[model samples]
Target: MGLNGFSFYNFPTAIELEYHQPLDKFEKEINEENILYGDKGRAYLKIFFDF
Candidate 1:
């Protein structure tokens, strides 16, 4: 699953937020553990300046 959002106003700046994760099952226990143990999901924030 994944999601994204952006905002733009009168200001000369823009903001973005995103999140993503695996939605499918793994074939092996090690694979599943490797994917789910540490960084199972990821998120990001970005800003843009327009001039």
Candidate 2:
């Protein structure tokens, strides 16, 4: 495969979520551990791909 053979594919929208604080009890429980990146809320990432 060469660079010329490649073409521009669909640039799917990248949705970025920001956690300001725990919105509900479930978020609070999960964020209590501090194992995640957030202190007041849980941090996460979403990837769109199906295999």
**Residue 35's lDDT in candidate 1:** 44
Best by lDDT: 1
> Can you give the TM-score per candidate against the true fold?
0.46, 0.26
Per-residue alpha-carbon lDDT of candidate 2 for residues 14-33, written as tens digits (9 for 90 to 100): 43444446554432335455
Model 2: worst 10 consecutive residues (lDDT sum): 1-10
For candidate 1, write residues 1-51 as lDDT tens digits.
334445457667766677776566554367456443333667888777773
In candidate 2, stretches whose alpha carbon ends up further than 4 angstroms from where it belongs are 1-20, 23-39
**RMSD in Å for model 1:** 5.6
TM-score of 2: 0.26
lDDT of 2: 0.40
In angstroms, how far off is 20's CA in candidate 1? 0.4
